[model samples]
Target chain A: MIGRPTAIALIAVGVVLTATAMVLPWYSTAYGGGVEVVVRAWGTEIVNKPGDWPAGELSPWYGVPVAVTAALLVAGIWVARAAVAGAAGQAGAVGVTAALVVSERGHAVEQQGDFAVGFGLVFLVAGTLVALAGAVAVQREAG
Target chain B: MKKVLSVVLLVLAAGAAAGATLLPFSELLISLAPGQPQTAYVTTGWSTRFGGTKDEHGPLFGIPIVVAAAAVLVGVRWRKVAFAGAAALAGVAGMLFVHLLNVISFHEAGNIAIDPGLEAGFGNGIWVLIGAVVLAFGAVVVHPDD
Candidate 1:
């Protein structure tokens, strides 16, 4: 069975990572071509730095990582009150976080020749780990 | 009253899922130049198969959301329906999350055209579906077996 300490620890780590990602940069560009142009970029809600492209122009779902991170934080807090219910929330967080990271990473590796993984991504990885640990803890508690 | 609420939630969730399908999931812009931005709409079905798009993401999440909503509506009287509904809703959330990932990658890679600058992002429909799934999950959790 999972210990309360372990569960709390996982939740705590997830909370911190998700929170950190909210403020960190999500994406950046690395131009390889010999085009010497002052290219502008876009930013997201959490990473609201003045980039070339206007932020929030694409869609609302672009801020999903932030939303999911916030939800993970809430799930971490809820676990203390109810393991079963909290487990559900944590599972959702883990699944979504993993999906977002994997897809983005795939794109970076495959599509973007001069792409860099951002802090938001790092936080997503950390949060996913914590969420997985928390899920295991909940299962252990139940078993 | 609880059953009615559950039905309403399920219906809303299903409606949102349907709406999500109708809405554009992502916008792909192939900007070869500063003002010449070619935009394309990525939907959830057969359209994605063609039109220089490779999106295997939408249906992955869309089908489940619709199926789960239907299940919840039809089986609300079951003893474990609440748990089932919760699981389904959660599953929908997870899939949608993955869907976003696919979108990011699609945009990130922007490899369809050998363009240096590839711009991609999700549409509003996804958030609507995700929010509806959360609401439906909450409703099930609050009153299971309704």
Candidate 2:
């Protein structure tokens, strides 16, 4: 059996990773100039304009989502640790499914046209299968 | 205490997952129908960045959220719950990561427009987070052997 603190720690790591990914430095090409790299803040946008990479400022409102997600992750882990394994597993499954669905949509947007069609289908089908498998696995384990 | 907390978590998690899955549809239906002419809500910068007709990313993450919830509910032991929670966190992290990437892509694409519907995106994230927190609380309350 895993310890509560360890479970919480795992969740904390995930939250940090998610936040870092948002603020990490990303590189992209300029329209005419060489490639440019910049640090992406939590609530900002990076744009390549007129052959130059520029940072577009986003409203502080953007941070609301990040904060909310962080809170949820923390709470979910804490609750899962205290609850029975079965319940915890179910909660985790639901959370994971929601996350996967959102991620797939992002993937579709990233790749459009034929790519969207192919990749979207893959995400839908594959993601559903995976979620189902996870749920079933949890059920079996809990039982 | 463990059993009671487990049930509570299960119920809350299920409710949260349902809400996350359905909220988008309600928003779309209320906004997109030509006859209705109601304001549409857009979440994420995907539409702004990619120049798409609609934002289609939220539903994609739904699958994983459901999976993670299920995993947690069915786990029989503490180790299982830990693993499941870890997986759930990973899914949440992945979603956030992709959104960040989208921010970069939008920046690179050179078209950053704030969607009037951006509130919807924030709402979705907030709700999901709430569900996650509730589930976590339940876990804590139901600590096995208590």
Candidate 3:
């Protein structure tokens, strides 16, 4: 069974990773020559843009949603750790993450670049994994 | 007392969902335009901005609102039906909202080359209809109890 600190730590890690996912790929620009300009976790590059931002480059502040999702994940983890868990909170966090990932993919459709699709899928998978783990932990504690 | 409160909660939730979806930023623009050619272009832009075009953010926001509403209503009026209806409505609403936002943002950015054919995908108009029906039914069901 996941203890309180362990649950909190997992949530913290998830939040940090999610935040990195949002902030790392800060920008993307296409300069022809098949060179895809993108901001990576390590540095900016001329290849492999990370994800699709439906709001577009003008509104990088849209990363607010990612931050919010991270907060929700944290809350879910806390609730689960405290043994005050419910399907609503867990479902809500998972739903939001899944929605965001799907939305990102939709936005990437116009760009015809694979970067958004790749990152979106990653987020979806990550969110699902986190949700499952949280649910399992909560169930174990509840039982 | 619990039953009454549950019904009230459901109705409120549905109403909130309806309000959000019905009051999209695009609707604001369309009302402001009031019969202009730019309406089409503006709508496209609005759709993209809100992620309606591809992302479905707009629909996503609306879904939970609708689901919570439906769940409350069904839970009160017909307990068994409440869960499935609520879940389905919420999921559909969420997906559509996201797509709508994507479309609005895309068009707004002068991405005119983007096809407007995916307009129906977001499901904004449909959810509004569903919400309205739920509201009407909920009123009838709750009034008798009161």
- Using TM-score as the measure, name the better of candidate 1 and candidate 2: 1
Instruction: Give one digit per residue, the lDDT tens place, for model 2 in A50-119.
Output: 3343434332223334344445554555454222232233233334334434554465346541111223
True contacts kept of each: 0.07, 0.30, 0.04
**Candidate 3 C-alpha lDDT tens digits along B43-133:** 2211334222333422244444445455545655654334333433443343344444554554445233243222222334545634644
- Over 4 Å off in model 3, which ranges? A1-10, A26-57, A72-128, A135-143, B18-36, B40-146
**DockQ for all models, in order?**
0.07, 0.18, 0.13
Ranking 2 against 3 by TM-score, winner: 3
Task: Compose the digit string of candidate 2's lDDT tens values, residues B1-146.
Answer: 66666656655664565455444322221233334343543443122212245544444444555555555555334534534453454445344444544544443343333232222223354356445546644564465633
Q: Flag clash pairs in model 1.
A: A40-A52, A41-A52, A41-A53, A111-B109
Better of 1 and 3 by TM-score: 1
In terms of lDDT, the poorest run of 10 residues in model 3 chain B is B37-46
The lowest-lDDT stretch of 10 consecutive residues in candidate 1 chain A is A34-43
Candidate 1 stretches with Cα past 4 Å from truth are: A23-29, A33-112, A135-143, B1-23, B26-40, B45-131, B138-146
Q: DockQ score of candidate 2?
A: 0.18
**RMSD for each model, in Å, please?**
8.4, 10.4, 9.4
- Report the C-alpha lDDT of model 1 over B112-142, residue by residue, as the tens digit: 4445676677767667767766766756655
How many clashing residue pairs appear in each of the predictions shown? 4, 60, 40
